[model samples]
Target: MTPLFSFLVLSLKFLSADCKTEAGFCSCSCQKKELIMKAVSILTVLSAAVFGFFVGISFPVQITPQLQCGILPCSSGDAANYSFSGTSMIGILWSAFRNTNIQSNGTSENHAVTKPKGAEKLPPGLVVTESDLHMRRLWGSPKEDVATGKYLLALAVGYSEKANVNATVHKFSDEFDVVLFHYDGRTTEWDDLEWSKQAVHVSARKQTKWWFAKRFLHPSIVAPYEYIFLWDEDLGVDNFTAEEYVKVAMKHGLEISQPGLDSTRGKKTYEVTVRRNDAGEMHKTNEGGRCPDVHQRPCSGFVEVMAPVFSREAWTCVWHMIQNDLVHGWGLDFNFWRCVDNPEEQIGIVDAQYVSHHGVPTLISQGNGEQEGSSEKVRARQWAEMHTFRERISNAEKERGNSAAALEEYHP
Candidate 1:
């Protein structure tokens, strides 16, 4: 107690004297204490921040569907639907396939398509083949692709794209297996597509408003397609598939199936050339039955090449009829259908499955309609020839059921 108590008393006295002296200098001792405390607290916060740099605190990030396609949350690799922001991908791929198919990307499957590789170049049982078309377009190293039984129901335009043909093909893609064979000269490079891998090199059937429906059959190479679907390219197709076409034909036992067609200027399918009676007066019903008779269901005039689906049997029946008597490159479809007689010979018309005709000439406009500016007079002459052929076909059908009568005459 003597030494310890003596030291403790001295330390307490020293602290008390020091505090009294400090308090004399600053009368607000408690306030000073708070200021010092706040400064120390700030310093402590700063030290904690510095330490946190070395040892970080983790937090979660919000993952969202903001980075997706078509308003759908899709994974990495699945092929999903997308809106196209650029030019036609289908035309580009088709052109690329035709160009490169024989050089670097010659498809082996296409080569082996013909049953006897030595006998023919393509598969058997083709109804219409325009294999000669490869020569029409200045293709030196043109490649022939045997279709995987996929047919393109096309309808080309005349004078211009008055039938909305391009738009029809674009929308038809969602349902039907179609190939829009356009004649615009802007050849595209299909750099992004993988055509050599999966897509079959389709040398499919092509029909056009001007070519098949309006014009006569041109000398074609791919014309041997088992069932050439000669129709209007501008025809609309609502919720229809390739299989549905086959199903309708097979189910109905139809050799020829003519779907409903729309006139660009009107609401329902309009009648252009009508039938006349013995008095030469145009009748609601023509002798050849241009528009369907009242007893018959209201129907389209001619085959509506805009949406005509021909079966193999029908093809065999009507092909020879048009092939022998093709006046020009127009009026072949109607003339061919005129030959289809057996009321049993069916041409299925699915009005529900529709497509719009008279497309805006986007492709043609983009290409500036420059076909080497060949010969204006020559072009005019050719157009006149085409329309003349169309008139001849309409008149012929009025007199005789084109294909039906032709077949009977030919066979009998």
Candidate 2:
């Protein structure tokens, strides 16, 4: 045999020997071949795993489609009607992802995702809702019909002749939503009048007007109304029309204001606050040298508590300032200007449409059944309460002088 034939014969013999093993079932290259084959198997597995991962990323699973209602998702039944669009799907996915993230942090998703209670889900920066009060509708009233004349008139009334309050109800009932705070336990005919159906009656025996206001006329309760009139029951509204008064007050930009006091019928009336038929909406006349600096603000803005009206903005500040113990708002008039930046420009007496302060302490007249002999004792108690209120206001002003000065400097 030649060298090539010898080599071929040797290779065949080696392969046949390798195929045979002591165990007699397929064994080859006991160390070197085993190692090489194991490496190849690992490489093949790694390559397959990488390829599978890429395929999964490229063709992701689609979740069940959903539709939206306002800022929230629609129910399953409602979602069925509409096919999922790419844009809407993206929004829904984004919202779900946010909710998921919130839940992951151990916080409830409702506060962040759901709309406010009883409030329409409005877009950001649009203030369509205030305090979530379900506004009561009254027909033929300026408060309902006129855009700028949205106001609520709150009267502090007690057991007296219903005829007195009824007269007021008849005259201005078409212009205001009259709310009566009954201080007398004895029932009256207030609910019997024709317009009484439209009014709100709150009963609490022997509480002052300020007391009722602090407890009841909260910002949330009166949030729907533009102005709040905390009036006494004895006001004579013969010349006052709510429409004209609101028009004039809005035109003049009075934040804390009132109808000018009728000079004839009103008592404890300030010279500047007294009504003048000829004067226009705004007045700062320095009569009898009371307001020496006529040009200065708040000199003319002063109004008595008996018939004062507070704009929504002004009422907010006034509400905070009211003291629960000081039920009678005696010193409030002096500090009314604190609520406004430029009181001279924003506060005024509505001279054209004025009311007569009947000067009757009707509430106190209905003496607390146990405490009094007559109206004289009630008058004395009122005097004492008012005096204490004034003193308390003085002390408060002194204590909070620095803070008040800072507030006065605040620009709106």
- The sequence of per-residue lDDT tens digits that candidate 2 reaches over residues 1-412 is 3764565455456545644556644455554355556556765876898787656544434333677786798753345335332223333445554453323321222222333444435543453334412236566775564332257888888657466677666655354666788888644566567666656678888778888899888886678678888888887888877777788888878897888877787664566678877676656454454555565423465776888888988998888878787776656776787788887777778888887777776666566556557778767766676667556656767786643442211111
Global lDDT of each candidate = 0.40, 0.66
Lowest lDDT sum, 10 consecutive residues, model 2, at 403-412
What are the runs in model 1 whose C-alpha is more than 4 Å off? 1-147, 150-180, 189-227, 230-233, 261-301, 316-329, 343-345, 359-412
Model 2: clashing residue pairs? none
- Tell me the TM-score of model 1: 0.38
Error of 2 at 142 (Å): 22
Task: For candidate 2, report its TM-score.
Answer: 0.60
C-alpha lDDT of residue 129 in model 1 = 35
Model 2: residues with Cα > 4 Å off, grouped in runs: 1-149, 173-175, 285-288, 291-299, 366-412
CA RMSD of all predictions: 26.1, 13.9
| Maximum-TM-score candidate | 2
